[model samples]
Target: MTALLSRPGRVAAAFSPAHIGRAATLALHDELALAPKPGLVSFEDTGSHDDMDAHTFMRSLLALRSYFTHMAELGAAFAPFDALERSGIEAEARMLAATGGINTHRGAIFMLGLLCAAAGATQADGLALSADHWRAALQQHWGAALQARCARASVLSGGRAARQYGLRSASEEAALGLPVLFECAVPAWRAAQARGLSGQRLQLQVFFQIMAELDDCNIAHRGGLEGLAFARTEAQRFLMNGGATRTEALTDAREIHAAFVARRLSPGGCADTLSAVCLLHRLGALG
Candidate 1:
């Protein structure tokens, strides 16, 4: 008998890209504009400020990080999925997964996001997507041109990746009090580089506290913002344990992050708990 650890995948050749026309892109934009997540609480009609306007309970942190990273790595990843050579690209994405370099769970999530984006370019079907059929999300696009691209991808890859990781539907961002996006690169990356920044403990601590607040909101309600909060708080604790220098700013910042961590909004198991503690040792959030 084969061990479960060495079992074969139920699905094969999970995701691949298909040629989509110009209209597909437009349809994708429409989907972004119209897609909604069920069980969303306290929504803001406007798409402004990711901080307070989105729903996030069913959200997967690993998925969102890939979403951000895929946007970051589009140049490297897009080649395979390009319309001209999608078959080759799809093969490559699969190969990358086989090599264990690509994150299997996240890779699927990335495809779902792209496929969903493509689906938005069409009005092919009027079928509202449930969690299961989101890979076939084109039905909900009202039969737009983007649905054609989605259909193509579905036909080629059988929508395995889309179906596998199409767990959360995108919705309007929540802006509890913060802005839509947190460009950590500003003070955290670029600014530090320019300043030849060495001392970051305090700043890192403050950022952690901010994240804690965000996570608190997520626990109170359900939204995508929790991931960022989780990442931030973890980063803070790791910094604290590192024995960072005590400066006026640094001390104050550390206090804030520490305070947030001290307040437990939800119960976390080893993974979440350890991660929260792990981050304080780092100099700042990213580094």
Candidate 2:
């Protein structure tokens, strides 16, 4: 069992809707606070985005505060995916209203929300809060439904682009148990922490690692296949050269940020994945 839930009394409190929801919100906040992010928003400045910024993301986070809590509540009741889907739809509406129709956390509402639900369900089942257990809970409870949803067509631009480019959509990633998060991003985070890195350096290491790997439908939508390839290559080169450990790592990252912004490219999917890693770390799922 994880330390958070090792005690009997602590389990209920740990699994509370408010606590779980707060963790989800804080994870997004952590992601937003990371600077020198390639083609992403931060408290310092907006990168490659005129439609949204730190303020817009804050509004969306505030609006979503209750939605994640509600999802956990539903999961504790073992509610079906249809119920969760309805809740997500409602939450998305609230987010749009808060951000004036800007889609800042749309992907997060799907990815992190599901993780929160699974965390609730896992705790309710008296299981460990490890990544393995949470993942199992998600698959056991919602895998079939998610797979069915994945097979359907998406009218969204990102989804359309994924289809056009023969890349895996976010829906497909979720249905397959979020391999990028579980298989790639989490490991990168663990490796960074193991190297005794802290704060923004650790975050930068993981973010660049994700950017190098994630197929990022957002990149495809904005920059197309060529753009996606360029982004992957740049991110990979950053890691190969020295990543965040180098003395001039921040400068190099800022340069990459400038390049991405110049091309109007934003790796939103990678950003969402980074937020997922934050959530997992907060939940004690990242040893």
Highest TM-score scorer: 2
In candidate 2, what are the lDDT values of residues 1-287, reduced to their tens digit?
22343556444335576788889999999999999998999998899999999999999999999999998888877889999999999999999999999999999999988988888888877776788888889999999999999878999989999999999999999998898998899899999989888889999999999988888999999999999999999999999998888999999999999999999999999999999999889877897
1-287, model 1: which lDDT tens digit per residue?
11112125322211211222122222222222221111111132312122222223112232233232232123213222343124324434543444344322222233333433323221122222222232333223322333333434342221332233342111111111011112321233334344443433433333333343323222222222443355455546544554224345445533433443344222111112112222211212233
Whole-model Cα lDDT per candidate?
Answer: 0.28, 0.90
Error of 1 at 100 (Å): 20
Whole-model lDDT, model 1: 0.28
